[model samples]
Target: MTKSTFHAAPLLTLCLVLWALPLGAQKKKDNLQKPMAGPRATALRVSWLYVSADLGAQKVGRVQIGREIVVAEKSSDWLRVFANTDIEEEHTSDAPIFDTNDTPPPISGWIQAKGIVIDNTPNGDQILMGAAADQEALASDPRGPVNAARTAHLLYRRLVEMFPNSPLAAEAAWRAADILWQLQKADSSSRPSAKEQAPYLRDQMDEDGLKKVIKFYPNTRQADFAAYELLDNKLCGDWQGQEKCPEKESEIYEKYAAEHPESPRTPQALYLAVYRQAVLTDMYTADNNDKKSDAAHNHARELAAKLRDKFPQSDYTARATMLVFKLDQRIPVYGIEKE
Candidate 1:
């Protein structure tokens, strides 16, 4: 559960590749600037980019609410921007295109200035955060917009990039990373490899964004949450009736619990460890390894006791208590149940 401390080496390499532009090269090339040089902005509502400043100008593309943009110039009521419009189509939304070094080329056009929020806009961070939350809610609903989740992810990322000093920055970063992770997880879970017993057989969730959250926002609750998400990549896709799967996974969860004792996920982690131990008890008994079975039973009880002592009010603690009672009554926690 304890990963190697993240360093800037990978990021440094990426920077060299993406931002090695000669001085003034960015400005000379179609007025497109590095993201940091321009005033970061997002659409406050679904809008359109036009080929010209006039309302009758040909439509260049539709800009979804929360799509990130960088303003290079502004007219009376129009802003010239380089918008991140290379997003994957809604039908093939499995791939996320927001990585620092892997971003798609931007589209340049004029957008109406009315519905845009720039970095200097008053309370812009709060406005962006609220928009992201609304999008997230839509993403969770079956009848919501097809691209709501992606928009939410983009909005959250913009909040962190534009308002790094905002009190909401840490949570925004975590939310962005979590949304991407969940999208990737859902995509991976639908593949045939998802039926594999070993997690490595399936596609792995990208860890770069999660690692960035931990790197930039260390010691925060969001960092702890990000770390907890990383564990998903190491878990078994299916236990496959193997005691070793649960045994190793239990150790991993226990280590996370010990390292991040105050994390909101710690109680659930402890409960997972207890559940695995209970499964191990049944598996060992089936193998006629009475000694190991007895040991696992005792360990399960001990971990359950710890959960109750440390998180008495937690739902996980209550679940662990029920598990312990079933163990004491010689009930099978795995395999076919007795009638």
Candidate 2:
């Protein structure tokens, strides 16, 4: 071969190797997190993970109800599997996991196949949704499992991920996001900064999942629910005896009502606007600003009228009526009444 041909051959080999390096690295990275090759499954009850397929085998851990697993092999009534066993510690006080990447490695063990629901199981989406609803109810009970909320959240998430085309996917996604938002709200409320008047002064709940629900399920009732939850981030932590607090909050609620007239939350938003304007009327009265106070009173009455006209049978309309009565009677809706 010519000397130039030899040199060109080496150069071509080097170029090919350089091009393959990134692909090779990406493949390795993907392999590191690749789920076990098997049908995705979840437990129907609290099941024990054993070192072997026998009931007498050493117990390694547990598979909580609705926790995702991959069925790799089976022996009669027992199945060998890889399961996500990341059980968070029971928190005595409100606390939230800040790190999203804290997933523990999946544990490999054997569990009973009797209660295992696979992705292809008939009515699997409904089954998962029911299980998640059960867990959510348990989460609300004072004596229920500490991780019930988190488990329900995960189960709902798994339903959405595993059965994206199912009829229940949108609702499942909303429930998952709502659970996480509530959990974060509880933790944020427990902090000292929660007493601050401005929302910016306090820790905020993560909004990415809620935003995803709105993005992926537009025009759905679930999307409307997510949009209402987003308003919590814009609210004052505490009114702090300020007129501006109610003034600003009333505007926020009024805008929400106008923009989402068909939303289920519209009545509540209107009621909130009425309530805040009533409070502002009181605040302005206390400040001896009669002009602003009269304007606030008129606005409160107008919102109450809107509530009654728009949502005649709504409970919020009744509440708005009561607020209007108080405003007309000169009863203070906020702070102490003038002696």
Candidate 3:
């Protein structure tokens, strides 16, 4: 779904907010071009999910420097790193906030994660700054609807740009496609002049990206959302809506049914296609006063009958049947002069 306009922040504004900091503090640049552990050093090993290491309280602001690996007696546990800080600030705090006894620092860096750093210290504010940057980036995105619909289209384009072929990328693609479909339904007018409508057509070029995500990660939560969104978007419009609607249910029904005939959702998909066609036809005939022909009304009656006969247990059967009765009542009497 699109986020509220009130919540959207411009990307530049977000960058500025994230980078703003107190002046005169020096940031250390890593001098080593590449890591070099001598032949005697053992390589550092850690798991992505759970690697335990104790960070000492003294090492708060200073950067921890160490070889990639150390020899002989190294255990499987993560190696502890320390930063020596002045005792004056440490002691001056009102409470005993410092965990002097083998406590670990909350800040951490993932091996795969990479980005520009902005902070006063190498360790403390640095990590916080990275998180802040990410948060600001997320906040700055103005992708959601600005109207009552609360529709947001997360473009897979952005996801693929930031992360390629990763799980997060897959997730982003799925969410983006889902949001795009919601935006389509909530705002029928995707024309540039329609300010209330989100600009998905202009923004997205990630159909292939989305397909890859669904193909590779069908069991993921985002994949499930993508599947539903694809279904909904595919079923939202009728043949008459071809020019206005990005997706057409009639087309989708034919394809989905042919491909997955045994699928449990096949019935629902076909029902929606017929229902949309009938609804749109009925609405057009009713609005135009049927001056030219009774084609639309006749089609609606035919579709309604088909719905009732073919899917006796469908919920749409009741609604369609009701519409048929209503149409019958109105056809002979509507807009005619009384004697």
Residue ranges of candidate 1 with Cα displaced over 4 Å: 1-36, 88-104
TM-score of 2: 0.82
For model 2, residues 87-132, the per-residue Cα lDDT tens digits are 4422211333222254344677999888788888899999999999
Model 2: how far is 259 from its true place, Å? 2.0
Tens digits of per-residue lDDT for model 1 on 1-339?
212222122222223334446565654556644444457788978888899998999998888777667777899999988775545422222333335454445677899999799999999999999999999999999999998898898788778867778899888889988998999999999988888888889899888888888988888899999999999999989888888899999999999999999999999999999999999999998999999999999999999999989999999999999998998999999887676
Candidate with the greatest lDDT versus the true structure: 1
Which pairs clash inside model 3? Answer: 1-152, 2-151, 2-152, 55-104, 59-83
* Candidate that beats the other on lDDT, 1 or 3, i.e. the better one: 1
lDDT of each: 0.81, 0.80, 0.37
| Worst 10 contiguous positions by lDDT, candidate 1 | 1-10
Per-model TM-score on C-alpha atoms = 0.85, 0.82, 0.35
Q: Residue 213 deviation, candidate 3, in Å?
A: 5.6
- The TM-score of candidate 3 is 0.35
Name the lDDT value of residue 283 in candidate 3: 46
Pairs that clash in candidate 1: none
In order of TM-score, best first, we have 1, 2, 3
Tell me the spans in candidate 2 whose CA falls farther than 4 Å from its real position.
1-36, 87-102
Clash counts per candidate, in order, are: 0, 0, 5
